[model samples]
Target: MNKVQSDFLSLLENHRSIRHFLDKKIPDFDIRRIITAAQSVSTSSNGQAFSIINVTDQEMKKKLANYAGSQKQVEDCSNFLVFCADLFRLEQISQRLNVEMKKVLDSTEMFLIATIDATLVAQNTVVAAESLGYGIVYTGGIRNNPEKVSELLNLPYRTFPVFGICIGYPDPNRIPEKKPRLPLGAVFYQNEYPNFDEVYPYINKYDETMKEYYRNRSESKREDTWSKTITDKRKIPRRMNMKSFLEEQGYPLK
Candidate 1:
């Protein structure tokens, strides 16, 4: 491989979500650039149906942290951004332009499009933030109680808070070590898809690698593997009431 390819691959390989950060604020210019990177990400049909809210109010952060399962990072980070799937913006534009928003707004396809757009843009922001020496952690617990979160953010009917991201300069002392991932054999496929037998072994091997990772973490070490962790996670129905929440937000999922 060429030097450039190797260096870029190394950056991709070393990614770890930063939960603990120094109490330093990111500069406004850098924040703008990071958000620009997010905006630069391609969207479905160029709809750009997503919006971000940067929560600067400390009281609001504290309230959001409590709402998001008490994740202290939400309150402690230099910047906290809520990425929302926003059809309301487009709805207003359609109304101004004399277009029929009803044709798109109330469908499952619109929900999927907004969700994909929001997630992709946020992921782009993460890479850009890391490139500029900032640390970040994405919190999906923002969905724990969506109605209250939506109300707190003053979201319109056609909007839903998908996730929250905390950004800041990394605290050198609190940097987390990178964990292992599943092998290519488990994830990548050529022309045809491999059946379970070919992929199952890789998952087992990844579990072994994750066992070491969990055991060696600087804080909150555990005696579990990737498989066990996933199993335990699945035992509980995560986001069981999200349907009702989404319905409340004007997405009956029809």
Candidate 2:
């Protein structure tokens, strides 16, 4: 294969989330370079409505670990970063320019742009961290209690926590297995989404593959096929209240 194709295949085939981490600390220069790479991502309209808070304090990491669904990686990892979607900077700019901030903050389109900006930045950080030999995990559970996370991080109005990322050296003793993904044909469609008639067979095979993967990799032997996992999560209504939580956090979503 060509070099680009070889690297792309390596990246796709080897990507795995590492939760168990060694006690070693990552150096400050590497952290700075990784974050610089993250900041190099293209932002929406160059607004750059995102910021990352590096949490190095042990006490704060402990508290954040609790905030993020009691995930031990939050405390055990060498570094923790809270990625935030921030409109507050633009609001400040508006004040300095004597322009109205209300119009920008109230628009749903602006909110989406800010969210996209944050997500892009976080993903860039993940890739950069991985390339530098650091293992990383994205903690979506940071939003399990948005208010609590905001309070812990001292987030100002118009800035919301998008997610937390933990980065560190992986513990050699606890090597994680590479998780399987759906076949490319299952997700890719020409010009439109594939109909169920064209997709269900692939999904069924994928479900079996996932089941076998879980059986081998997990000690708990969780009977979570892809479809069953999706059904189980959707059946629970708790994650649906995220809209109200976002509104409460000053998104306004108008």
Candidate 3:
């Protein structure tokens, strides 16, 4: 990689999901730039099927905080945003242009396209926020009650809240330790995917690294390893009703 590319990557490698925030707030100009960066992300067939709702109303944010795993960060952060898969917006456009709807919003590929668009927008927004010295936390708990999130936002059909983001200045005294990740070999395959046997050694190495990380990365250290954590979490189903939720949101997802 070039020097600039390497430096940018070094920045990305230091990313952490900050849950606590200082009393400081993000500047309005920076917020606009961050969103502009999000808008710059590529979309499938230029579908641009994503929407973001900034939640600044105190009472509403608190209600959302309650729904999102009761994470105080939702209300505590300088800014909170919900990214949504928004085929409804495109559907409106198609109507204005006198287009048919049957093959557009009802197909499984259409759902995938919209969801992917929302994800890319959020990911780019993260990069932009980090570049501006802001800390961000992505709340998967937004899905803990998707129906509530949608209802609260008054989102139309063909729209789904993918996740919420909390953004603010990081508390100096509350900086979190960076968590370890799986080693490159196990995840960064080349021309072909490796079999389980070939990946076992890298898994063992990563497990050892994560064991050390969890033990020393915090004041209240825990006993855990990468492989063990994966094994434990993999067996449990999460968001099992997500399929039904999508269907209810007007994505037949067929």
The candidate that achieves the highest lDDT relative to the unseen native structure: 1
**Relative to the unseen true structure, what is the C-alpha lDDT of residue 37 in candidate 1, on a scale of 0 to 100?**
75
- Clash count list over all predictions: 0, 0, 0
The per-prediction CA RMSD against the true structure, in angstroms, equals 1.3, 1.6, 1.5
Q: How close is candidate 2 to the true structure, as a TM-score?
A: 0.94
Give the alpha carbon lDDT tens digit for every residue of 121-224 in model 1: 99999988987889989999999988889999999998999999999988889988887789999999899899989999999999999999999989889999
Give the local distance difference test score of model 3: 0.90
lDDT of 3 by residue, 105-219 (tens): 8999988899899999999999999999999999988898999999999999989999999999998788888887878898999899988799999989998998898788866
Which ranges of candidate 3 are over 4 A from the true structure?
A: 1-3
Clash pairs, model 2 backbone: none
- For candidate 3, the per-residue lDDT at 2 reads 100
- Worst-scoring 10-residue span by lDDT in model 1: 7-16
TM-score of each: 0.96, 0.94, 0.95
Q: lDDT score, residue 69, model 3? A: 79
Candidate 1, superposed: residue stretches over 4 Å from native? 1-4
Task: Superpose all Cα atoms of candidate 3 onto the true structure and report the RMSD in Å to 1 decimal.
Answer: 1.5
- List pairs with backbone clashes in candidate 3: none
